[model samples]
Target: MTLTIFSFISFTGQKSKFSDIIKSKMYFKTKLKKIPLSLVKQENTFFYFTDENPYYFNLLKSSIAKLGILNPIMVQPFEKKYYRVISGFRRLQIAKELGFTFIPARILRENLSPSEILTAVLLSHPHPLSLTEKVRIVRIMKDLGISTSQICTRFGSFLEIQSPHLLEKYIRLSNYTPSVLSYISTHGLSLNQALAFENLSSEEQNLLISLGTCLSLKGYDFCNILKVLKEIETKEEKNVAAILKETEILNVSKDVKLTRSQKIDKIKKILKMKRYP
Candidate 1:
């Protein structure tokens, strides 16, 4: 048997070549048919963004606003000159809002590979990320010799949940109005904050978002404010003015649990330290 095995090994230039062929036959096969932009079609392309697309939205509207547009919205070109946006709805709307006529897009030139389809998916959706996620993304992009945009387009954006406490706020906003998500996307609402509002009961979120709907009321952190509103039975009972006064929290306060009487003492102690220390 040993002599036979040696003969077989000698007959083959390299045993590894046989193994490679077998291994290659069992791999996954997924590819996109890259139809030309003219072949592909576009319809109803300019829709306001929705919260449902967890892949496209990020935590900070400010970041998106600051970054401007890095990647052009993707579209399948159809009928020669027209095309449908396969991804980047938010980008398209913002560009429209920002006043631009022609947006950048990629038309299919050849049959897309499985990897290319996956890359398009990665581009379209990004996961929520925290500061650490951003760092990890940067590192991965560096190691892979790719840009953040490329990685994001190929892989979903992985985000860290930065603020859990304000989840209800996002929910409330969504409940308050249908346009709440778009408002958050357009305004400077944070992703965690938007998600927080989204978590609220539909009715409650709509109510809260409606109340906070002015274009000027951009930074609507919903949690405590919504709580204060709910604490009062009716909108009339919710002294909106007085609540706004209380809405201001010293962001750097040392929070401590205390009974009513203990709370009084704690405040006194805080004041003394503030004045003296």
Candidate 2:
């Protein structure tokens, strides 16, 4: 990704707010250069499992195919012959598909620690990131000796996270099963909804995914369904499949005539009308 110039000029021998203090110490002087595409390797360890944003990737690939890459990717030297990509993964991938041998990049100076490289990645991305990406970054920071409090303090506003308390929630989200996580990624599962699913056994989580697909559940509907299911489980102390047999939710979800909202509404009414005794 293009490492755009960020102004840290205020910290140059002038008194600044406490917030700027930590950021001031972490600046890297980057230089723009053209690096061979073959030399840059995609490293998986930098972040947790993140799904490709196909919409963005396609749009980017199409754009680069026409106008060429408007911005450079970020890289740091790995071995004597290869460099590792820190950001702009999609751009690099698309560039390769377009049959280009080299791409523009800003190569960081040598001996930068993993934390520093990660910090630069966090700072250099121009747009808001996906939740998985955020989780990945936090997971890596924790891996590299940065505390959650420090990460929230320094990058919270930039990441658009509500609070430091929520950091743990995202970290927990990172541990979800890949299938469930993929569903979460596709359906845009909210924090509460994801946590709700986390309380389930692995089998139930998979069932939830199946149930969601059958119903074509929206975000609000998904949360509501989970809430009702959770309440029923708590009240009756039964697993999800047993509870599902108690209502027509599965059958109702399969009906093509009803809209998603109508499905959720019907399911809720059914759950509310039934008694577990």
Candidate 2, 113-227: lDDT as tens digits:
6665665565555556777667666666677776777666555655555476798898787677777766777788777667777767887777778888777665787887777
Stretches off by above 4 angstroms in model 2 are 1-30, 41-45, 48-51, 245-277
Whole-model lDDT, model 1: 0.40
What residue runs in model 1 are displaced by over 4 Å at the alpha carbon?
Answer: 1-41, 44-73, 77-82, 87-105, 109-118, 121-178, 195-201, 218-221, 233-277
| lDDT for each residue of candidate 1 in 1-277, tens digit (9 for 90 to 100) | 2223223434442344333322221221212223233332444322212243344445333445677566545554445556666556666656555555556554432344433332333324444433222333334333445433433333221222123332223223323343555556545566454554543455555544544542123454344344444444244364433433343222112234434344334433443343345
Compared with the true structure, model 1 gives a TM-score of 0.35
Largest TM-score belongs to which candidate?
Answer: 2
TM-score of each: 0.35, 0.75
Candidate of highest lDDT: 2
Error of 1 at 211 (Å): 1.2
Clashes of 1: 37
Checking candidate 2 for backbone clashes, the offending pairs are: 1-73, 1-74
lDDT of each: 0.40, 0.68
Instruction: State how far residue 214 of model 1 sits from its true place (Å).
Output: 3.1
